[model samples]
Every structure is written in structure tokens, then in C-alpha cells.
Target: MGQVITFGEVLMRISPRGKKKFIQSNVVEFFFGGTELNVGVSIANFGGNVKHIGVVSEDFIGDTAISYINKFGVDTSSIGRSKRPLGVYFFEVGAVMRPSTISYNRSHSSFSEIKPDMVNWDEALIDGEWLHWTGITPALSQGSFDVLKEGLQKAREKGLTVSADPTYRRGLWQYGKDPKEALSELLHYSTIFIGGINEINEILGTEYSYSNEDFIRASKQLMQAFPSIEKVFDKIRTSLNSSWHKIRARMWNGKKFHETKDLDITHIVDRVGTGDAFAAGLIYGLRRFDDCKAMEFGSAACALKHTYEGDVNLTTVSEVTTILEGDISGRLNR
Candidate 1:
């Protein structure tokens, strides 16, 4: 298989240990992750060839972050450096009835300084078969949006499949550009839509409810609006509480609509990056299995991510397959 190229920021995530509020705990834990980086790392752990392109601080912190990604076997050669501190976010992990909260401090970080000229799209897309991008990257700054647009254009010219996950955050789009306009332009270059009805409604400025029927309608409207989008995949989550949640996946691949059984996660260790795991699983699966099986793989991967603590899903292909085979008992293996 050719390489999967992921482009976005690399962030250092800090969290209080074990559901403790910031005021209740003096200790914190840190992990390296970003939306696209998490997807790239998970795919790499699945034994797929993956490369991540982003910017980090030109310091030891950046060195450590690169080491973390390198240990996962993701190619980091395309990553660049700048004379700014690495972006950092503080995540307060909640449990039971409490909801998790995140605060970002990435306004002047190195990734926000990225420019289209810094990335040699020809070199990055040379061996790439798929390119993955998220709305967060473009929401950072105009420069990031331009760079991502340029990369998407290059990927299109090279005939590489482009996956767009418009993980929209109203707060992130502090730049003057309209979120709908920016995301709409990027969606034009993407072939796979890794989001749901809410996202589609947000981009298209429509009122689509959460019903499955509305989901199908919204997806069809989305495909009609953006002819480049061939498939739509969504990970539906039903949260019982911050710690207990259920996940399932549904997809409309032009011809048929498929949905998977809900994978109940009674205890969630960390909820961050689960969506990225689903995206990674789908990308890996679509290249190997049929559409229905691929959606199942994505949902299984997403369910397994809750068992890990960090921002990236560390589960291997065998582990995910075990879950897919109906083995969520957490049984001992000798």
C-alpha cells in the first residue's frame, strides 16, 4: 500500500491525573497528539505506511514530540520546525456526571506560522495514496488554510484519495474567514467525508436533526453539493456519562447506507482522539476490506481507544480485530 499522508498541528496535551480537577490536583500528565497526527500514528501502528506533516517548536520539546511520534513508526521527515513554543492544551478529564473540558494556548505556536511555501507538495505526495486533513488545521490561521488547500489541490492532481474531517470548533475560527466558506472550499478537494449530520448541517447551514433518516438526507445533500465527496462516514456516540459511552458507526457510500451495532464502552479511560482512531481504521480498512466491514473496523477501533490514556490509540490491528470478533470481555491472554 502507498503511504497515508496526514497534515495538521502537533500538540502537547496536558491533563490532570485520574479525573482530578485542576484545583484538586497538583500533578498532571502529558501526551503528544493532534487530530491528523493521531490518525497517522494509529495507521502506522496498524502496519500501514504513514507520514505526518506539521510544524513544531525548534527546541528540545519539539525533539521529544518527534521522538514520541517516531517510536510509533510514523514517518516524521516532512515535519518542520519554527522558533516558537510547541502548542499546548490543558484537558481536564472528567468522570461519571462531569464533562471533560479543554483549553487551548496555540495562538502563537509554531504550527500557526506554517506557510504554503514551507511544504513541498510534490515531494510529500510522491509516494502518498491518501491524504487526511481536519478543520482544526485550517481554523488555526489563514496561512494554515492556504497550505492545506495547496496540499489538497496537489493530492487531487496526483489522484490521491483525500479524507476530510471537519471537526469544527466555533472558538478556533478566530480568524476573519467564515467557517462555512473555508470548510466548503476544502471539502471540494476531499473524496471521503469523515463526519456526521451535525457537521454537514454546520457547513451547509441547514437544519438536520439526529435521526438516521435525517442523517441519510443530510449526507445525500452533502454529496450533491460537493460532487467530489464519494462517501460519508460518521461515528455516533451516546454518552451515559463522561466515563461510560456507546459508539457505533454509519456510512453512506453513494450506493448503499450501512450501520454497525453499537459498541458499549462502559468505562472510558480517555475520550480524546477516538474519532481520529475511527478515521484511521476506516482509511486502513477501506483499502483492504469491503465498505461494511470497513465501517465495523472503524467503530471497533474507536471503541478500543477509550481503553487507552493518551491522545493516540495505541491498539494494534490484531487487538481491534479481536474486538470485531466479539471479544470485549477483556479476557486474559497467555
Candidate 2:
């Protein structure tokens, strides 16, 4: 089995205890999470050897972040320490009919200030068969973008399969550069992309309506523009309330489109890292199953992530396979 290597930031996520509002909370909970790092944890939990590469502050806060990811069995040897402080964010869990909210305090963090030389691509990527990243890294700063571009170049030279999640956080892209320019250059080396049509429009400058036909048009446009991309996928979500969501997913594998059935989730424990969970599942499925089965397994992982509290999806392959097989009975096993 080959190793999956993820490149991105690891943030210190602070949440209010329980369903309390941020202002009303007396206690807080902290965890380490970020786009690529979250996917790394999910793949590791599924029994895959994964390596996470990012910078951490030379402080205890950074130490804690490293320990958190390490707990999930992800290799942290490439996560270096620096003088800048670790990035952090605060979010409040919302119940039915109320929407969740997030506030970030991540500027000037170690990972954001990272340079291309900071990450030794040749050493960090040794024995790495898959490389995963997200748009969030490029949105951080020019320095982060440069590092990502260099890393992606090296990953391509090494003949590794590259996957990316275009997580376009509006507020994170205030670094005075157009996201399209930065992302397009890096995505030229990507083989798999996970994001919605809106994200594709924002980053690729293509007009795509939320219709099924338009999705195909957009996917074709994307693949044409970037010949390196072989597959484009997205999870279609219908939120009935803060607690209930119905999710299905679709993927365009250059030659055809494959979709999954709706996985209704009426009780969402946490929805923070569901997309990353889906990305991990898709990567896992692509290696072991066909496109249709991969979409089903990936969507099942997304649905199951809603029942977990933290950013990392701790569900196993057997558990996800059970859900994919229509065994969402939630019954106990002896």
C-alpha cells in the first residue's frame, strides 16, 4: 500500500461547549483541523498510511496541534515548527432552524507565512503515492501559494496522483490576488477535483447554473482547460434545517457521470468536516472500486461524518460500506 500525503494548514479550532452560543458559553473545546489535514485523518482512520505536511509555531499550541493529528495515526514528521503562532478559529454549533457560524483569527500564522523552501518537497514526498491539497492554502497568502505551487510541481514530477478540494472561503482570500490566477496554475497539475459548481465558477471563471446539464458542461470545460484533471466531483446537499440534511453526490470521470442516492441525515452531530470526509472516501474508493461504487461510498462517508462531533471522521471502511449497502439501521452490533 502506498502512502497518502496531504499538504495544508492545521488550525486550532475552538468551539463553545455543547450547543451554547459563543457569548453564553463558559467552557470551550479545542481541536486541530483544516481541509487537507482533516482528509489525512479520515484516510488514516480508514487504515491508510497518510502523511501530513504543514508548518507549526515553535510553541506549545503548535505542539498540541501536532499531537492531535498524530493521535489519528497520521505521520507528522513533515510538520515543521516556526516562529509564527498557529492559526485558530472559533465556531458555534447550531441546532434546528439555526445556522452555524464561524470566526477566524488565522492571519500571520506559521502556515500562512510559510515559504516554498520551508517544505522540503523531495524529502517530505518520499514514498508518497497520493498528494492532497485545497484552495484554502492558496487563499492564505502569496507565500503559501508559492509553497503550494512548488510542492505540486514536485509531486507531479514524482508521478503521484494529485487531488484537491476547492474550499473557497471568501474572507480568507483578502491577500490582494485574484484566486483564479493562483488556483488555475496549481490545479493544472491536479488529477482529481472535489468542489461545487459555484466554486468552479469562482475559481475557473466559468458560468455554470445549478442544473444537471450545466454541471456536465462545467465539468467538460474544466477538463478541457486543464488536461491533467481526470475527475471532477461534488456533493449535492439539501439542508432541511440545522439538524437535518439530505445529501447525494455526482462525479464526472471525463468519459461519463456517476451519481449516488440520497442519504438523508436527520440528526447531524457536526457538519464541519463532512466534505473532507467525502474527499477521503472518494480517494479510497477510486483506488479500490469503480466510479459508481466510489461515489456511493464517498457520499456515505459524508453522511456518516454528520454523526461525529469533531472535524475528523473516525468511521471505518466497513462502517461506510454498511451505509452504502442500505444498512443505515443504526442498530448495535454484538
Candidate 3:
């Protein structure tokens, strides 16, 4: 199998412990996480050769982030150092009837300060067969968008299959350009895309009515607009509460639509990296399984992530396979 490459920031995530509000908590826990970095870690945990490329400050927080990435068996040799501060976020976990909240302290961080010339794309993509990135990266700053665009161009040139999570965050795109325009350029180079119905309408200018036909229509329109696109997919989440959610996934693989079983995920330990888990699982499955099986595997992997308490899904392929094979029995294994 070919190696996977991802480019984005690695942030230090701080959250209160055991249902404690940020204001009330006396103790806090920290974890290393970011969209692309989370995916790289998940892929590595699944026994895939993966590399995480990004900029980090020459501080202890940056050192911890790089060490965390390496601990997961992800290659961090391409991680560059900067003088800027490392990015960090404060997360407040919510209980029933209340929603979780996140406040970013990521502005001016080393990764957001990245320049287009900092990375040698040729060297990064040398042994890479797949390249992954998220829309969140470009939303940070103008310089970040430029580097992301340049990376996409180089990844294309190297014949690396590109997958992107079109994660639209309104707060981060303060660089004075419409997100639709910036994301359109990146989407043009992506072969596999992951997003929701609302994101489709917002970014691709397609009217999604939550119907099966409209999904197929929108998927076809998206592929037509960007000829390089081969597949578009999404994991639909139905939140019963902050602690419980039912997740079902679907994919439009150019010719047809495929949907997976709905998984009722309860007592979610940490919901932050579930989407990245699905993305990683989908890419992993695409390398081995058919579209239907791939979607199922991805959905199963994400469901398993709810049991873990960090940003990265530490679950192995065999664990996910057990869930995929309808063994959600939490019984102890000998």
C-alpha cells in the first residue's frame, strides 16, 4: 500500500475535566489535535504509513505536538519550526440540553504564519500516494490559503490522489475573500471530497433538499464543475443529545449513491475528531474495499471514536472491523 501525506496545523487542545465548565473547572486536560493531524494519527494507528507536514513553533507546546504525532507512529520529519507561538484552543464540554463551545487562540500561530515557499512539495510527496488537507487550513490566513493552494498544485503534479474535508468554519476566513471562491480552487484539485448537504449549498452553489435525488444531482453537478473530482461523500450526524448521536454516511461515486447503516453512538467520550476519523477510515477503506464497504468501514470507525477521550482515534483496524461486522458488544476480550 502507498503512504499517506497530510498538511495542516497541530494545535494544543485544552478542555475541562468530567463535565466541568471552563469557568468552574479547577483541573484541565490537554491533547494534541488538528484536523489534518488527527487524520494522520488515525491512519498511522490503523497500520498505514502516514506523514504529517506542518509548521510548529520552537516552544514546549510545539515540541509536545510533534512528540504526540511521533508517538502515534506518524512521520513528523517534515515539521518545520517557526518563531510564532503554537496554536491552542479552549474547549468546554457540554451536557444534556447544553452545547459544547470552543474558543480559538490560534491567530498568528506558527502554522497560520506559514508561507508558500516554506515547504518543498517535491520532497513531501516523494513516496506519497495520497495527500489530505482540510478547508480549515486555508481559512486561517491569506498566507495559509496560498500555501494550501500551492501544495494542492504540487500534489497534483506528483500524481498523488487528493482527498479533502471541506470543513467550513466561518470565523477563520477573515482574510477578506469569499470562502466559496477560495475553496473552489482547492476543490478543483481534489479527487475525493467529504462534506454535508448544507456545505454543498454554501460552497458549491448547489441547492440540497436533503433528498436522495438531489444528493445525486448535486454530486454530479459538483463532478461536472470540477472534472478532476471522482467521488463526493458525507457522514450525516443526528444528535440525540450532546452525549448521544446517530451517524450514517453516504457517498456518490460518480455513477451511483451508496449509504451505510446508521450507528447509534452513545456516551461520546470526545466528539471532536469523529469526522477526521471517518475521513481517515474512508481513505483507508478505499485502498482495499468497494464503495459500500468503504463507507460502512468509515462509519464504524467513527462510531468507535466516541469511546475514546482524545482527538485521535486510537482504535485499531481489528477493533473497527469488529464493529463493522456487527459486534458492538463491549464485553472484555481475553
The TM-score leader among the candidates is: 1
Q: How well does candidate 2 match the true structure, expressed as C-alpha RMSD?
A: 1.1
lDDT of 2 at 80: 85
Ranking by TM-score: 1, 3, 2
Candidate 2, residues 231-302: lDDT per residue as tens digits? 999999999999999999998888898778899999999999999999999888887889888878889998
> Which of the numbered candidates is closest to the native, going by highest lDDT?
1
Per-model TM-score versus the true fold: 0.99, 0.97, 0.98
RMSD of each: 0.8, 1.1, 1.0
Q: What is the lDDT of residue 222 in candidate 1?
A: 97
| Residue 168 displacement in candidate 3 (angstroms) | 0.8
lDDT (0 to 1) per candidate: 0.94, 0.89, 0.88
| Per-structure clash totals for the candidates | 0, 0, 0
- For residues 287-328, write the lDDT of model 1, one tens digit per residue: 999999999999999999999999999999999999999998
In terms of TM-score, how similar is model 3 to the real structure? 0.98
Pairs in steric clash, model 3 = none
What's the CA error at residue 11 for candidate 1, in Å?
A: 0.4
Candidate 2 residue runs with Cα over 4 Å from true position: none
List candidate 1 stretches off by more than 4 Å.
Answer: none
> Per-residue lDDT of 1-334 in model 3, one digit per residue for the tens?
7779999998988998977887797899998899998898998989999998899999887888888888988988889999999999999888776888889999889998898888888888888999998989989988888988988998898889999888998888887978999998899899998886877788777678888788888888888888998998889999989998999999899877888888988787789899999999999999889988988888998998888887889989999999987888889999
